[model samples]
Target: MKKVLMAIVVISILITAPLIYNRAKIEWNNDTYEMIVPYEEIRELAIRGLDTDTIVKTLYDNGVRGISFEPTGIQDLVKQGLVMTLTKSDLFSMLQKEDENTRESILYSRENGLYVLLRNDLDDRWENAIVKSFGDRIDKVTDLPIFKGESIYFIKGISKEELTRGMGAVANPILTRPIGFDENLMTEFASYGFEPVFRIGNNINENNEYVLDQMKQLQDKLGGHKIIFTGNTMLGVAPHKDLKTEDAEQYALRLVNEGFVLMPIEFTKQDGLNIYAKQFNNKIVRLHSLDFFDGRGGYTDRATRAVKERNIRGLYVHVADIKKLEEETITAEQSFEVATQELEAITSQMADKHQPGIAQSYDLLQASKWMTIAGLVGVAAFIGLAALMVSEKIALLTFAGMLLVAAGYIVTGATMFLQAASLVVSIVAATWAAISGEYINSKKDMVFKFLKGAFLALIGVWFVMSLLYGNQFLVKIEEFRGVKLLFILPIVLTFLHVIRDHVKDLAMTVVRNYYLVIVAVIAAGLMILVVRSGNDAGEMVSGTELVLRQKLEDFLFVRPRTKEFLIGYPLLVLGMYIIYQGKGWEQRIGKYLLAGGAIGFLSTVNTFTHLHIPIYLSLLRTVYGFVFGALLGLVLIFLYRLAKKYWPMIQERL
Candidate 1:
């Protein structure tokens, strides 16, 4: 039975080798990223008497690769004094010596309705967009022959208070409705060799057909479909109902088919983004931005780390505060100089690994059904082998049950089941390795035991990685669940296993020792471990520790986890030495120490569960952890020997 299980593991590994290779190739090819700044920021500089062409050229020379452009709206036109809005009463008061026909036509419209007057300088696209957006609620007042050459329309079912004072009125209502992309502005940027990142707005009330048509026209004009959607929802998505399930799927399909890649901002909430990205086959880049007005420092370091460590491809930079520039407290030249220096610092830090260019979606490998099934079978085999360490009966029962579960999951194709099974396999593997080292007598024996445990834990890593393989996992649309459990469960299981044969003796020993003190210390340690498990655990990290982490990252390129190399691995070795070689009180405490060593195995497996990190980087981090941990463990053993040799003389003097 054991031979059969081993064979299944080997075959599964062979079957999934292609997936590993494809993932590596995709990550290797995606080595370029883009630095994008809002077009409005550049326009603000232009408004301050800085030449637009010179600003663009200067930014381009300093690692700026793209300019993000949001479409102009009626509110913007009003603010710029290119369009005028008036109530019917206001318009009636403005007109003097009008023809009777024009007067009669004006009287026919709603008395309280709002009228919009478009100047000749405005683009005709605005008129078309307004018509499409409002449909029957808006009417062209062409009956007035006296105002024939002027563009004027009356909007119905809207009050002045609703237009001016309603919540989000300026951003989401009819007045602030986006017309379309500014083609001339886009053309200017393209002429200066900037990739235009279209920032899609969701303020307009339009049907799906018109929304898709507008997107198609923009794509035709810009020649690319790199979209960064603004607001809480996506284009064509309704505000009240959100996007209907079918509509979202249809829109996602159309966009993907048209080669539109969405760049969702990291750490921000956007409705339906995950579903849309999943439908796009997860072929999207992640964008990172820090608010320049927040007054926090270290923007360059964070941006560089985003590119180097988190697979972030788009760095959305906020170069200058628009309000600050408008207030004249800061000059355009000063803002430009500051932005240039920051860009240079970021680019210089990342020059060794990435180059500034247009960010593209990764062409990742799609997992085949057979490969997924094989991965599950391998995980079941690993679980069975770990169970075999206890007894043949338990091993056989576990193998059969896990195989049946894998078969059922294959039939049902449930993702949650796969994640749960992977988590169980990881816990089992870590626990089994933690207790595998027994009768350790020499340094050679200790090293061999550690390597054996590491090898078994690595097998668990492979199984977890293969079972959860997909583009969704790669981009973090789907994550490996139960991370806190992954950190805690293995240690708990190891504790139970180490004490199973001596529970009565352990109870007595604990009562005789400083029972409350030990419990308090263990509880505190567990709390810290739990607090420091996830991606958002940066808040819990101390400033000194963060500096140390940065220094390690700079020196190693891929920093080894502190838990694995510094604390967990060394304690594991010390525990093994004391339990096997020491006499008296050391033997009693050694069991707990050995159980605590499970953290090392747990951390080794945990490293691979971060699916968004590149496989090569994870592998490098694991190697560094093991080498440094082993050396640290040996140093700990030397300290133990030195203390043992001098303890008797010191105690006699006392």
Candidate 2:
């Protein structure tokens, strides 16, 4: 049975090795990234007296490669004097004395509502867009006399207050409905050698065909293919009908077929974005954008780290200090200077690894269905082998049950089931490795024990990578669930395994004051570990630690996690040395240390779970951690030996 399991494992590895290599090749080739600035922000700078041409030229020279353009809406049209709105009272007052019949007809049609009037110079497309965006809420009223030679369009279900407030509101669902793209703005930026990055806004009552048609037309006009959706949903999302799932899939299919690459923003919640991007088949780039107000000061450092560390290819640079500009604290030129300096700082540091250009989607090689089945079999066999160390009966039962589950997953292809199974595999493998260490009689024995644990953990890592590898995971549209659990489970399991035969002794030790204090300290450390285990760790990490991390990344190219190298692995090695000493206190303390050492195995597995990171970088980081941790363990062993040699004499002299 063991031989059969071993053969299954070997075959699975052979099948998955090629898939891993292909993923690595795709990631390595996706090195180019774009430094994009919003066109509205640039237009704001131009409004403040800076020349538009000069600002574009300066930004381009400093590695800004793309200009993001959001579709124009009624609010923008009002601001540009292309459209006007008035209350019924205001409209009646504007009517000439000779236009009594028109006024009487308007009063008969509607008693109260805001009326929208387009400029006479504008074309019919503008009216068509307003009708399409607002639908039945907007009514064309030729019965009323033309105002300033433009036709009257009466708006329903909107009060004057709502219209005024909604117009100035950011990302308002109704007021920010797409009217059309500003073709002249797109042409201006494209003339200055900037790739256009389009932002799509959701309209709850949107005409799906019109929205899709507009997107296709804009793509044709600008000759740029990248798109990012704005607001809380995608272009066709309808919350009233609850059509997000259906809308997302349909829009995704249309967008992909249209040859438009989706760019999902990092750290932002957009409903249906995950479903939408999944349809692109690895033809998407992850984007990182900073808030215009919140990111004013440290934009450069944050953006630099994003591109260098996170595989973020689209750097959405929001350099304008909108708050200061609104407060009149700085001149527009000063803001422009700050923007240029920020861009230069970020681009200069990243020039060696990345070039400024439009980021292209990765054409990743697809793993075959047979390879996935083989991987699942390998994971089951490996888990069974680990169980064999504890009990043959348990091993056989676990293998059969796991095979049954894998078969069900293959038939159904349920993502939740796959994620749960992968988490269980990770916990079991890490816990098994953590308990595999025995009495370490010599330095070579200690080293071998540590290496063996790491190897076991790595096998778990491989199993997980094969199971969850896909474009969705690669761009973080889907992530490994239960990360905090993955960090905590092995520690708990290892502790239970170590204390299984010592419950009475543990209860006695628990009552001791020093032991209670030590337990409290360990609990505190575990709490910190749980808090710092996710993508949002930056919020909890300290400034001093962040600076240290930056220095390490600079020096090592890929920084090893501090917990793995500095604390977990070294403590594990020291624990084994204590177990070898064969003293009463050593036996009692060594068990606790061994349980703590399980953290190293869990951490090793967690490193590979960050699917967005390149595989080669994770491997480099693990190797660095191993080497550094072994050296630290040797130092701890030397200190133990020196204390043992001199402690008795020193105690007698005292």
Candidate 3:
């Protein structure tokens, strides 16, 4: 009963804790940052293009309840049913509450799921907020020639003739897919306080299903009321060719039906591109005149006022049979509420990955590494390990001698280590320690012990070298590269210390005979070349039919999949079998093989953990890796047994 109560309490906290504690999502945008509630707080919406009425009702009909009318309050709806939205009243009510983070409201959308914009809201009112933003920079361009018409236009630097001539030649935002206007005027328009919008297609036939479908595809990429591009004639060369009214009407209807608001161009003909948009029983806004930046016309204040009054949305436009607007579409009074709550997400992700100011563009310079003192760390650990295997006094004396030599090389320097020199010296020391420990502890022949230790020490050297930026694996750990040292070194070193048993004579004999050494040198060299070149060999060795790692990466077994299955799984399975079935030295060697195999699986798993890879793809890769790897192992095991049986019969015949 106590366990059940504890379970219930945990589940309840999971369910209701969000309501008790809520924080607004802040994201990096422009040069500054903004909370998802929108910086402007004017016509800015907590979420754009959401149709809450039908969604709540449908959910309630299906027996989901405890949701209230407002986004926050005592009877409020929860964000993802985890974090509860709180009001100012809710904050004051918690008089004991002190953390400022929990007091902020939250915004959420059902369709987009935890939507947050990393950019500023820009001016929805368009009262020169953009002009004010770039006080001096605005002076660099010529003044906008204001034209008052059915719509108003600010065309100064760019002439209207340019609009007439260039629309077709220059790419339309529609052809651009994101389908809205901002070309050449994004910073300027944004300065005027206009929402940043991508220009989708400009030559959309409202009547054409294919054209409408294209519009829909773009709309889905950016949720809700993002700006769109629409024009009557070939975008620039226009005497205002009108699309068929029926076609215009259908285009408008379909977009609304599909739950998107139209951001049609102003003065679009054939019913003026008015979209009568209603999605899931909620009205959407359409913003117009975004193309004015690209030398298209704008609207008069009266027309702009009318557009605002009708609750149109744009950052620019197509118009077709709009209205049935529920209200004036102001952020303050309308149904679109930006409140605290609905920001419930995995707190860990929110803390680590979704915090504001982390959304800046990353370049190679941003990823540039400083020289790490990792060689010293490796050196210290190597000395410590050596001390355990030998006498502490002897190990310390040797380490002191190496450090004195290193210090001599760095005379007058503040630090005692040089990056390249220290790396080489550290590798030499680690190799000596690792090999010496193995050589002394094992009763195997001197040559085999030396060979085994030498091979083992290569791993340590690679690990120390991984401190260099060039050695880090770009994506997967399963790749045969220096990155494997990060995990492999520690595990192997641990077992060598703890599970020191008889060494495998057969494996040692192979390595000592120089045959395996030659093969391994060739294989290891090829692998190094592959990694050092970033797997793009076309630069170094070019010709038709000459395979590049980039090209090889596309095939199943040849790329990541092959690395995981053929190399990783086989080692894992074979190692496990040997550990279980083989005695003495074979078991010890099996541990090493198993460790190697594990690297493959882990690297592949790490590849999938990156949020960029789709969950389905990750799943597919994992399944393929395991299944194919097991089959390969079974085949190898079968072959080994077959050979063993046949060999005994042949020996008897001989």
**Highest lDDT among the candidates is held by which one?**
1
TM-score of each: 0.92, 0.91, 0.28
* Candidate 2 ranges beyond 4 A from true positions: 93-112, 131-150, 157-159, 162-175, 204-211, 240-245, 292-297, 322-324, 501-510, 537-539, 582-584, 649-654
Order the candidates by lDDT, highest first — what do you get? 1, 2, 3
> Which window of 10 residues has the lowest lDDT sum in candidate 3?
67-76
> Can you write out model 3's per-residue Cα lDDT over 1-654, one digit (the tens) per residue?
224423432343344223212211100111211111112221122233434343323222322211101011111112213223222243234533444433332111111111111112322322132223223322221211221121111211322233336455553111122212222333332333233333333343322224345435533543223334433422222244453444444545555566553333334542233233211122222233321112333222322222212222222211111121224433222322212111121111121212221111111110112222333334434444444455667656755654554454345432224333333333333334233322222323423432344333433333233332110111111123233342344335534543555345433664455867866874674455344332222334445423443354334322345555776566555555555566676566656564445444444533332322222334456566666776787686677668757998999999
Candidate 2: worst-modelled 10 consecutive residues by lDDT: 166-175
**CA shift at 522, candidate 2, in angstroms?**
1.5
Q: Write the per-residue lDDT of candidate 1 for residues 269-370, one digit (tens) a residue.
A: 887786688679888999999655558877877887888777789999987888888888889888877887888888888837789988988887588888
lDDT of each: 0.79, 0.79, 0.34
TM-score of 1: 0.92
Residue-level lDDT for 41 in candidate 2: 84
RMSD to the hidden true structure, all candidates: 3.0, 3.0, 25.0
TM-score of candidate 2 on Cα atoms, chains taken together: 0.91
- Write the number of the candidate with greater TM-score, choosing between 2 and 3: 2
**Across residues 521-570, which tens digit of lDDT does each residue of candidate 2 receive?**
98999999998887556447787988898798878877898888888888
